[model samples]
Target chain A: MTYCLGMLLKDGLVMISDSRTNAGLDHIAVFRKMTIWNEPGDRVIVIAAAGNLAITQEVIHFLHVGVTLPDEEEPKTIMSVTSMFEAAQLVGAAVRRSYRIDGERLEKENSGFNCSFLIGGQVGGDKARLFQVYSAGNFIESTADTCYFQIGEMKYGKPILDRALSYDTKLTQAGKLALISMDSTLRSNLSVGLPLDMAVYHRDSLELGMHRQFDEHDPYFAEISQRWSKSLKDAFLALPDPSW
Target chain B: MTYCLGMLLKDGLVMISDSRTNAGLDHIAVFRKMTIWNEPGDRVIVIAAAGNLAITQEVIHFLHVGVTLPDEEEPKTIMSVTSMFEAAQLVGAAVRRSYRIDGERLEKENSGFNCSFLIGGQVGGDKARLFQVYSAGNFIESTADTCYFQIGEMKYGKPILDRALSYDTKLTQAGKLALISMDSTLRSNLSVGLPLDMAVYHRDSLELGMHRQFDEHDPYFAEISQRWSKSLKDAFLALPDPSW
Candidate 1:
């Protein structure tokens, strides 16, 4: 299990992913799940994936090498996509390609071909966008009414995002909410752990604004974790006890 | 889908269950998921269920009628159980009996025999106990270190419980936490909804201390829902935005 979140705010896009991966309870490792394709001033594509590590890694490999859609004559890689929409389509095609290669084998072993991706960023003149690509390879973009997407172990962290995030939120504030959401997930689930990868892309910059790795001992993350927990406790205590 | 929660606290037990039952998105109805067998001064047994409505209903029926264990000649009903552990066993036995009657048929339909239960309360000369009965009819009791159980649509509501609940929490406070947890779930999930049924049992009282049903119009629930959202937003704003 893993946790990855992407928010498309009015100011920019904020994306975060955890580094824990596990084949089972006993076999766990830190495997970074965020990949960036940045060609400064031309395009910046970011993808955070969750699901079968092998499958997701293979999808990333396809994105790196290139993918050929049925109607296309030439293969297109993430770095070469003309627009954010093309980037999302390339990701979907890669997922489908992975399915064609491994889906049947996995089904025979009773393992579903599970993989999903949160792809977001800017490409040249196109507006910044965020998309959630499904295991089936189909994808949906975040709209004004729904400006965020979360994949993997999402529920524990969702209430905070649902309550706090909006399309009008500032890019930095959205990053803070994403971290708080991840903190909630880390506290409740063992499969999602430390060393998070986060990236902020300022709209239309066609370049990454900020990218950082957060692990244990990261002071800002530690402060956010401690202070958020304290605030939740304080808020809970302030609620009046039921008189009945 | 449903959400049922039970907490075993120093003061007693707090149990809450939603009343929504759905066959599919097109088919939904309100059916109370909680049942209580109160034999004053002898025992008080509360059962909250989640999963296939037919299977859970059958399990509840078996509990009410009686279940005869392999080693026992006489069948036992929840009200007849002497200890809280025995009450759990009775509930488990009821689940197994339900499986025997419908599990294979449901599996043939690819439904996976889905059903689980949260059972808690006290019996004469016994302490208050909380147990989460699984689909297979096995159950685990909550310990001092982990004094709560939640079944169905549980993840959205879990973070608050993990952060706010404790074995030493007062029963009323635990009830408040449960309500807040339920509010979070209700906000995030359409499958779990209004008209919640909650029961609180004071330890050694051998009877229910308080029982209430909260609907959409309930003022206190309305207050908690609004205030908690405001508090969470305030807390999020209080966290410093990332400088990077």
Candidate 2:
């Protein structure tokens, strides 16, 4: 299981992904799920994935080499895309390619070929964009009305995002909200562990603004986790109890 | 879909259930999911259910009338139970009876036999107890280490309960936490909605302590819903942003 989140805000984009992967209780392992393709003054593409590690890794490999999207003769790679929408299409194509190779075999084994991706970045002259690509290779772009997308173990961390995040939120503040959401998930689910990969991009900058990995010993992540828990307890206690 | 929560606390028990039931997006109605049988000075049994409304209703019906547990010669009704454990067993028996009648048919129809109940109350000399009965007619009682059980649409509302609730929590405080949890679920899920049924039981009382139905227009429920959202936003804002 994994938890990955992406936010498209006025200032930029915020993406976070947990590093824990488990085939089962005994097969847990640390695997970074975020990939960044950065070319200063040109484009910065960030992708966080969740699901079968084999499928996702294959998808990443396809994205890196190239994918022949439907209705196109030549293959396109994520770094070679000219627009954010094309970048998303390339990711989706990669997913579909992975499905073509492994979906049937995984289904036969009852694994069901589950995988999804959050791709958000700016390409050349285009504006920043965020998309959630499904296992079926279908995808949806984030809009102003719903500027955030979360994949994998999402429900436990969703309430905070629904309450606090918005399209107009500042870039750093959105990052804070994403970490808070991740903290809620980490506390409630054992499958989603520490060592988070995060990338923040400034809109139209065509370069990654901030990138960091947070482990159990990261001071800032530790502060956010502990302080958020205390704040939530305090906020809960502040609410008036029912008089009846 | 539904969301029902049961907490076994030192002061007593707090049980809450949302009233919304939907067969599909178009077929939604208000049907109370909680049933309280209060035999003053003798016993008080509150049962809250979730999943496959028809099956849950049948289970409740069986509990009301009678169920013959395996290896038992005669049928035993919930009211005839001698202890809280017996009451839980009776609820489980009722679930099994419902499954016996509708399980196969539901499976053939692709609906599946899905139903679960949270039964909590005190019988005569027994201490107050809470148990979660599964569709298989098996059940598990709550202990001090884990004193809460939630069924149906549970993940959205679980983080708060995991962080703030405990067996040592006061009954009213636990009730507040339950309501807060429900509020989170209602916001994030369309299937779980307005008009909640709540019952609080005081240990050794042998009677329902506080029983209330909160509709959309209820002032206290409205206040909690509004204030909790504001408080959460405030809490999120209070956390520090990443320095990077």
Candidate 3:
């Protein structure tokens, strides 16, 4: 399993994905799940995927090749989409291509041809945007009411994000929030492991700014992991234990 | 969907179940999911269930009417089983019976003849114990390394228990931990709603004690809910912001 989340904030968009995939407990492997399509200063589209690794990689491959959505004048790939919305459509088309290729065989085996993607970023003329594309090739964009989208092993990491994130949160604080959320996911679920991929996008910068990979040995992640665990324990201990 | 948990500890047993059940989001209803079978001074058995409400109710009824397991004695009911292990077997027998009656019809409709139960408590000459009974009527007892079992909407509420619960935790502390776990579930999941039914049994006491129901208006529950949420937010704030 994997966990991927994207948030479209006032500052821009933040995206994170875990890099572990397991067909079963014995088949666990590491595969980076984040892909960046960038033409610095023109457009920067980031996609974080979860579900079948093969399906997600195929979707990205389809996106890198040419595809056209209805009403578009040209065959546009992720790198050519004029706005974040078109970029989302391009991603959805890719997912559809994967479905066409593997859906029947996967269904016969009782293995779903399932994959979902968190696509977010900005083009030269549009504001930052984020979307969650489903296995069916349809997608939903995030708005003020729903500023974040999570796919995969989402439940273990959700309470913190539900309580902490908002569209106006500062980028640095949002980065911390995202890490703590990842930290919670890491501790509760063995299916979701590291090295985690994170991208912190600043508003209106049509370029991917900060991207990092975190493993067990990464110092900053090590500090965040140790510190967050200690903080949770300390906070829990500090709660007034009920006498009743 | 539902969420129920049972924990076996040195002080005795702790079991908690949410009241909500939903066939679908629009078809949600509330029903008590806990059943207590006690011979007072001889034994105390608690079964908390999740999955199809009808199936669970039928299993409870079967146990009440005495489902005989493949054993050396006359059909022993939960109240008469000498060891906690055998009592779990009695519950498992009921699960199998219910499945035999309805499994095929449910499968035809694409719904699982699905149900599971967490059974625990001390019986006459035995130490406290916990077991998870599957839809197939097979069961697994909780080991020292894994002292708790949860069914239904479990993930959102699991991190706290993973971090805090152990075989040696006091009954009172276990109760607090259970409540906090339930609180997290109630907050994040609409499918796992209140009022909650919780029971704490003392080891070898063969009696159920300390039972409570927490609803939206319950005073102590309201206090714990507010305080826990505050602590989480406060803890998040206390973490340093990312610099890079």
Clashing residue pairs for model 3: A11-A203
lDDT of 3 by residue, B1-244 (tens): 8899999887778999999988778998889999887678887888899999889999898888777887554676666667878888888888887888898999999997889999988877778889999998889989778989999999988988877788988787788788889988887899999999999888778788767888889887787777777877787787776767
Error of 2 at B222 (Å): 1.5
TM-score to true structure, per model? 0.98, 0.98, 0.97
Candidate 3 predicts chain B with a TM-score of: 0.96
Interface RMSD of 2: 0.8
CAPRI-style grade of the A/B interface in model 2? high
Residue B219 of model 2: what lDDT? 92
Number of colliding residue pairs in model 1: 0
Q: Which stretches of candidate 1 lie over 4 Å from their true place?
A: none
Sort order, DockQ high to low: 1, 2, 3
Residue A137 shift from truth in candidate 3, angstroms: 0.5
How many pairs of residues in model 2 come into backbone collision?
Answer: 0
Model 1, B11-72: lDDT tens digits are 88999999999888999899999998888888888899999999888888888899986578
lDDT of 2 by residue, A1-244 (tens): 9999999888899999999999889999999999999999999999999999999999999998999877999998887888989988888888888888888999999989899999999988888899999999989999999999999999999998889888999988888888889999998899999999999999988888999999989999899888888888898899998997
Interface RMSD of each: 0.7, 0.8, 1.4
| Predictions: Cα RMSD each | 1.0, 1.1, 1.5
User: What DockQ do the predictions score, one after another?
Assistant: 0.90, 0.87, 0.66
By summed lDDT, the worst window of 10 consecutive residues in model 1 chain B runs over: B64-73
lDDT of each: 0.92, 0.91, 0.85
